[model samples]
Target: MRVAAFLCEALTRGTTHAEPLAVEGNRLDFVDTLRQLQPDLVINLCESLAADSRGEILIPGLLDLLGLPYTGSSALSLGLALHKPKAKELLRARGISTPAFAVVQRPEDVKAVDLPYPLIVKPAHEDASMGVDFDSVVHTPAELARAAIAVLSTFHQPALVEQFIQGREIYVPLLGNAPRRALPLTEIHFGQAFENRPNIVSYKAKWETESPECRDSTSALCRLEDTALEERLIQTAVGAFSALDCQDYGRVDLRVSAEGVPYVIDINPNCDLHPGAGFAKAAAAAGIDYPALANRLVEIALERTHGNPSHRTKGPGTARRVDPPNRNVLAGRGPVRHRAGGPRAHAE
Candidate 1:
């Protein structure tokens, strides 16, 4: 089947994270060319548009209106995943463990946090460690207020002040939808440089490739000596993924405490799919190469939308899965601007 890879041009500029030349390559007119070619399916690699993550769902939404099939989650799922607080509320309601979090829209709102100290503050709707740093984890109310203010003033979004989970960071990548299977657990290894820093994936550690933090913060397939604990982590991750209503392939990030309890931190449906990314790395550990993984994503989308491809191969993408909007409180609307202590609200 003819396939088109959709990517954002914003990543190439103002960030050393991903090589624009390599990611964009010769597909400069990728979107336009995609419209011209009208491929059988789309492999969405575009995390955002013009550096704004809110635009991540726009392309997929367009594809839906165009009556096209695409890999990964739907437009609604992407929106829900981008906003951290909304996703957390969904997980907590599912009986899955997520750190208690309060969204601070103003600097003074930080004082309203009823959760414990040593909270990690982050931009409410960003991914890939954006607006996160070592200083984001605060030990006192003053530091939390400063961090939340910084996030509010800089990113111009509400700050998500969550209880900092001091434990091992585990990443779980799930494939398929109905009978989704979790890949081998991957752990972020904070190297020697992080001995003095908090064990969290900060912005510098994730984006600044040449920085020591980036060099030291790494991911490796975790080896679980206890099979029961391993199964529990996988089950928790799967539960979190299902709670968010993610489709196709997605990754769930969790933090395991000293007591061996796992807390879901983030659910990324349109996570980085680079061959070197955590999702692909976990897939590789499970014997699924990049090509196979890509094909499998397409296969899953096809199976869900068109039923068995063998029987419905003749159609012009007539059979499509109509994803009904989730009616839950955390349903798709926009970035939820979480209140300090009251009802959860969102911002664009």
Candidate 2:
């Protein structure tokens, strides 16, 4: 079956050099291109969309409009996962352990939310460590406020002020259902001096590939952990996944406190799938190579489409059922409403 990958042009740039047949474009162009191709499956790897600009939900809605079968979580799930504060609230409400966080729209808003310091400030709506830096960990409320404002102004979004958990940073990759398999846990090990600074996967640490802070400080060390603790991490990660309603494949980032309790920092529904990325690395650890992983995602999408291809096969006279208005023709004003035991008349 023919497969089309929908990803941002920026991500697809280097990819074409290795895979000459890969089609790449910006989000809108990519959607149009995919429509023209009409491929059996579309792998959506585009991180952010224009609708995400103002926090408007777009991903799943667009896919529905396109009537295309695509891999990963639906638009509702993606939108929910993208907003960190909302995601955390949902997880917390569901009895899942997550880092305590406060949302800050302005610098002054920081004082109202009394979270402990050495707090971490990050763009509330961004992922991939965007707008996070070494200075994101603030030891004082004033500094926290300043960092929050900087993030809000720079990223044009609210700031997530969270209590920084200093401990082992672990990422749990998950795949499939009925019995979801958690791949080997990957840890971020920072050297001694950097220990004072909370083990943060900051924006600089993530994006600035050539920065000295990264070169001199952190390392992504996999295959290093005790068996019992590793099992706990996987269990907690799975709990977070179920709590968030994440589907297909994704990754959950966590920090194990000194006491060994795993606190979820983030749940990524549409994580990076590049061969060099963390998700792919974890899949490799589970003995599923890059191509096999990609194909599995496609398989999941096809399964979903098989159940509901109405969106894909839409045509004239294909209109589905709709509930009629709540009014009785005989009454002319309103319909009789039922309240458990009896029917009652309601005015228009």
Candidate 3:
């Protein structure tokens, strides 16, 4: 909410007011609210609808039906992105590197897996590390079956089993269109909380504020001196972004293999935008202040809007070749924040 206020104020130049519209569950009410408010533009910070992650893929379709211009990716891209395996297929089709993997809706389905061991399994249709935990990183067929079964039963979705890339977990956020700019790269550093455990961001590490995994995990400005490697990382993420036809702003997550090859691990459209999160941190590292980022993204979307009022922006990712700028580096410890009192709820 505070972040919204900053954006509202920043965009208020030459305007009356800008605000956020909160939609809980009532679909009609949301549509009616939009009809009434008739917002000039929408930032599309919605992460989900009615507490369901998949529901997020529908919001843009609604906005488009009402002929509204908005920030972020289109509904089609969102659909491909939410389904992890589908996004990987698109990436591979583009000749981009992603982990080798398979899907399983039933325990026995794991038998068809030809990939090597030490695979990570998670709910195929979910995001935000929702069905992932210590057991997600499995090494044996029995463990793989248990993990796949857990996802099938708990999340009621097919399980995605991919070869686990053991190395650095990096996030690349790209903003704008025609020339999408990749922000400073950010890396997740695992602390003692992950000792002897896989360096994956489990459900607890991400959302359970009180958990040790959350406590010890930190997001820091990735300091890679190898200009060539950095370029590869950014271009790989950009490749994934374009393959999905994502627009405005989005993030691509990758895990560098032990052999130093960066592989796309996740494509997060409409990724977290809280000031304390990775996207905002990368923006800040790029010398883009919070309000500036808020304002700039609006301009990006508005540019696409005025350029073609009727046509939805869709094309191969237009990447601007940008060189990295010096960063604050989160003072070396990384920009780590936590919800102090209790666990942050994972759902609506």
Which candidate gets the maximum lDDT versus the true structure? 3
Q: Please provide, for model 3 over 1-348, each residue's C-alpha lDDT reduced to its tens digit, 9 standing for 90 to 100.
A: 444555666666543346666656535466777777666677776656766767777778888998877888899999899898998888989999999989997878989988898999988887777888998999999899889999999888899999999999988888877877899888888899899999988878878777898878777888998888899999999889999999888789889887779999888887766666778778888999877887677667767876632233434443311213321000000111232333222111
Which scores better on lDDT, 1 or 2?
1
TM-score of 2: 0.76
Q: Cα RMSD (Å) per model?
A: 10.2, 15.6, 8.6
Give candidate 1's TM-score: 0.80
Q: Which runs of model 1 end up more than 4 angstroms from their true locations?
A: 1-36, 309-348
Q: Is candidate 1 or candidate 3 better by TM-score?
A: 3
Residue 312 displacement in candidate 2 (angstroms):
23
- In the range 1-348, model 1's lDDT, one tens digit per residue, is 001221222121231111111113223344554556454555565556544678777767867876666777888888888888898888888899999999998877877898987799999988877788899999998898889999999999999999999999988888887678998888888888888779887766776666677778777889889898898898998898887778988888889999999999888886666565677778888999876676577668778767755235444555644323321101011222221221100001
With candidate 1 superimposed using the best TM-score fit, by how many Å does residue 161's alpha carbon deviate from the native?
Answer: 0.2
Error of 2 at 77 (Å): 1.1
Task: Select the stronger candidate by lDDT from 2 and 3.
Answer: 3
Q: How much is the lDDT of residue 225 in candidate 3?
A: 83
What TM-score would every model get versus the actual structure? 0.80, 0.76, 0.86
Model 2: weakest 10-residue lDDT segment is 327-336
Clashing pairs counted in every model: 3, 1, 0
